[model samples]
Target: MNRIREIFDIGAGFENIIEWLTEEADWLFDFIALVVEGFLEGVNWLFHFPPALVMIGLFSLLAWRVAGKGVALFTLIGFLLILYMGYWSETMDTLSLVFSAVIFGLLIGLPLGIWASRSDSAWKIMRPVLDFMQTLPAFVYLIPAVLLFKLGPVPGVIATLIFSLPPVVRLTNLGIRQVPLEIREACRAFGATPKQMLIKAEIPVALPTIMAGVNQTIMLALSMVVISGMIGAGGLGNVVLKGITQLKIDMGFEGGICIVILAIFLDRVTQAFTTKDKS
Candidate 1:
């Protein structure tokens, strides 16, 4: 009883700070949500549909461009797995949710990372916040996401975005920082502007590392999709969640296997793209 009271007292002691931070975060989340909603509406107006067929076609082209015959076939097999499993709609929902999260994470992370790489003070300021974000447990993020975003794919997307954003930020910062001092000096000698240095020197050298960060971000986001389904994010995850609630072993098992298959396929494709060949 005494310990419980002490914990409550401690929490009460920080109530003002907590409340202020919460309010600030709420405003930020609302602003971001509005921006995303606008972008999504614009996309819907242009695409007029889910664009899965477009994605499949693009993936095929990408596979041919990257890994040739074997990878293209693998891409087809992955598509068929979702189709045969009767989870096309669910998969599309998951894709949309993951895509939104990844795009937002990149948009925010890459620029912040580039800026941080430019100054030691900036890196010191941002590093611990990212460390805290990366260290926090997955489920903990979902609580505020649900409270603020109100339980659906939107909240799930926000949670997944927060959960997955750290890697890209950290890696992007590292990648840019690791650019050789001599190369930067050479660029400077050529009278290149900061913008030109970044575009011509930094990003190209950093591309592999940035792609690796993206790969990690995507995998983490996919992992979160199933957990997010608890609050209305739909995918093979919802199938697994249903199986658990109803004690349907086959459904759970099959869904689990499908997730594994999808993960493998994505990892392979992304890795193929990242692993540049030197002749």
Candidate 2:
């Protein structure tokens, strides 16, 4: 068995493919890195524009409006606690990372989801690919990402985006597929164009499920962003990474608390959207 496994050497073949892609894809990677860096910078600026307190208040207000007074109050207090712990800027940086990953994941996942929902063959192909993506070890993404984009938030973004994509795609496909048969038939009977029916009837009903997927994607991205910090993704992730490696328990704990606070805030806000129709 050992001899047969050694002879198979599938791992080496994958390594060779990675090596080839790394050597051949420099221009493509450079362009992607440029775009990702610019996006990160823009999002970072948005998060940093106002005073930390002001930004906290703004987010709190948004939470109040969308989620509820309880969530808003929690947002205010949690951010204030992070600020008091002196991790506010790092927290902002992490937010920018999560935000960027989610946006890109949605852009890629949503279209693929739509395609899969509309076509059986597309779903058949996408199922295995998405399953592979989700089931693969999260850190494995970092390996190729670093080879392609090097150590930084660019690779981090790439890794996080890929890690977080599957839930949104799968849930989106489910949501659309689950849209009622009657509504689709009624739309067709009304002589609604396919485009109009899809846009008007299908998506609206599917939105709650899709939003749930988005929430899951955000949570999943948060997990990867911290891991991505090992490659210089920056943000609170690096703080936690340094704290652990250097044995600074207080620092590690503080960084972790901030991440938890941020995660809860985002999770609550996004989850609230999923409950909108129910409410």
Best by TM-score: 2
Model 1 residue 18 lDDT score: 50
lDDT of 2 at 17: 86
- Best candidate according to lDDT: 2
Model 1 lDDT-worst window of ten: 39-48
For candidate 2, list the clashing residue pairs, or say none.
none
Put down candidate 1 lDDT per residue, 60-178, tens digits, no spaces: 67787876788788777777776677776666666667777888889998988898889899999999999988898899888777767777777878889889988888889888988
TM-score of 1: 0.86
lDDT of 2 by residue, 172-279 (tens): 999999999999999999999999998999989899999999999999999999999999999999999999999999999999999999999999999999998556
Among residues 3 or more apart in sequence or in different chains, the pairs in candidate 1 whose N, CA or C atoms overlap within 3 Å are none
lDDT of 2: 0.94
The parts of candidate 1 lying over 4 Å away from their true place are 1-28, 38-58, 277-279
Predict model 1's lDDT versus the native.
0.79
- True-vs-predicted CA distance for residue 127, candidate 2, Å: 1.0
